[model samples]
Target: MKILHTSDWHLGATFEGIGREEDHKFFLNWLIPFLKEQEIVVLIIAGDLFDQTQPSAEAQRIYYQFLLSVSQKTDVKKVIIVGGNHDSPTRLDAPAELLKLLDVFIVGGISVDGKDFSRYLCSLKNEQNAVELVVAAVPFIHEYRLGVRTSMHNESEIHSLFKEKIQNFYFDLADAAEQIAQDAPIIATGHMACRGSELDDAPQEIHMIGTMGGLPSAIFDSRYSYIALGHIHRAYRVDQSNAYYSGSPIPLSIKESNYPRYVQLISYEKGSKAKTVQKIEVPVLRKILEVKSNLEQIHSILLNISWQTPMPPILAISVQVNSYHSGLDLELKNILKNKFQDASPIIAYIRQIPAKSDNNVLASKEAFSLKELTPEQVFLKMCDTYNEIVDENLLQAFRSLLNEENI
Candidate 1:
């Protein structure tokens, strides 16, 4: 039986203010054909199906459209989707009954009744009606939903409770899968961050709830044949190849550009203890480039950009300067427009980096005591740090509110 493992689709995500509908559509289009070509029987999307908890209507449309296409276009018999911290359990679970007809199992979250472990355990069978694989589809467990009562006052106690609850949850599911089909390979799915996983210095949000530390990889026992994980956006193995993160199908941040996006195909022969894994790289639908240089260097690079490509790359430019220069911004924008006239480059952001001397001037100020400043002064200083202008009317309103509160 062949199963394709992928995660962190993060559909409906936008790069800066620009929508990624087309990028995601391209990925889905490419994936459907690959699934058919590979004759993959089961597809497992570990988590984070949507970029946000409440996805846009278009995002929902894309998701359902892909699922419908899979059923109609591919030989895939079973699909397992688990929810991540970014997903709304209710939203993902809404089409549970309908999707079940398509042999797509969605585990949005843990059941309200904690005792019902059957929901998380599923069995996939071959054409002959024999169980070929057993899956423990565990979704993102909100720490509070784990039903562990612990003193929130003590940090160590809270971590202990969370660790215990999470370990027990998987333990129950694995136990159930074993009971159902001991011979069948038990593949487990998780949407939480695991310890020892490498994280990129990207702007992507890491969903850390309650505690900062991740669950130890040791939590996944040897009983399971393979453990598929999500949350961390980089594809890597945890402890061994048997446990791995498929990562996101597309890059979510600039730091992620260095890592190649791909999905893993796992094949297991009937009655065989070993499984073969293959990495299938996903094609880059669009380019995300981060350029860092001085103002002159940036100008030269932008002017020399080739227009041979169908579309210009989405760029994040960081130009070092002695101070903020409106001329430099205008020049870069005009150059980019002239270079790629038909398809204008999407500038994700233009960060202005003050020169060392300028930084030294700013750093020369002695650290002011917060207690010495008035509320209005503190607010103004905070706004200055971000180069934001504080409106006089808004400042007055704040002062009035402060006076009324007798502070």
Candidate 2:
């Protein structure tokens, strides 16, 4: 049987308050037919279904509409959706019972008690209604949910505790999955960032090998034949393991424009232990481009874009200038938007940067005032100045406090 894995839909995503619903709509429109063509028995959305904790009503409509299409238009047996850091557990779980009636399983958060891990075991059956596969729907397991309960100032201590808790959480879930089904290949879903994405703790440790240089493949139990992961916006196989990140369907940020997004198709032949994975490229409905050049060359650089984008692109331009000039952004917007009259580019961002440093300022080191620094950055700088041995934990704690205070 074949299963399709995808994640980080971020439906209602926006850049500088500019709505991103069009791109998502294009993707969803394509996905419905794609699922039917692939004849995928199960569909897994690892996490981050929405871009915001409290998504807009339109965003919610897009989500439910897509699910409705999959239910009525496709022959998919099961639809599994887990939550990411941006998801509000209550919001995702509110209509859980109703979604299940459509064979769409939503797991926003694992129970805090951890006793209901077995409830997360979603069984996927074949046409004959015989159990063929099982999925361990593990969502974003925040450190606070574990023993930490809340963020504290001790960085090293908190990090160590968090790692141990994570390992134990998976171990227990593995135990629970095993008890339910032995012969069925146990596939697991997760929404954690790779070690490379969280490199603040050990910046020196570069992943020259598997899982994009961060997550230990061993963290996942061996029983899981295929581990579908989300949170990292690029599709890659975890080194030394069976885990794979299917990545975001559309480029969410300018830096991600070059990333070729894809959804994964994993197949396991009947009574065969081997699993084969196929990467299906997602169609680019709206293009995005970034231009970093001086003001004199900005227009030429944009004009020289060679990509035959499916649609007129969204542009993020960083213009280097010798000095500040008023109305420069507007001037460029008016000039560039007319370049493609048939499908004009949307100027999403425009920033003017100094082409050269101030003549009087020292070039030895860059300097910025406190106003330019976030409170956490200032705290870290103070720690460094005092020779205090601090780590990411302290920084996280500071941010947690700031979040609580709504700073």
Best candidate according to TM-score = 2
Using Cα atoms with residue i matched to residue i, what is each candidate's TM-score against the true structure? 0.84, 0.86
Q: For each candidate, what is the lDDT?
A: 0.77, 0.76
Q: For residues 242-263, what per-residue lDDT tens digits would candidate 1 score against the true structure?
A: 6888888887766666667889
Worst 10 residues of 2 by lDDT: 202-211
* Per-residue lDDT of model 2, residues 116-147, tens digit only: 78658898766687668889999876666665
Global lDDT for candidate 2? 0.76
User: In candidate 2, which residue pairs get closer than 3 Å at backbone N, Cα or C atoms, i.e. clash?
Assistant: 155-393, 195-214, 210-239, 211-238, 211-239
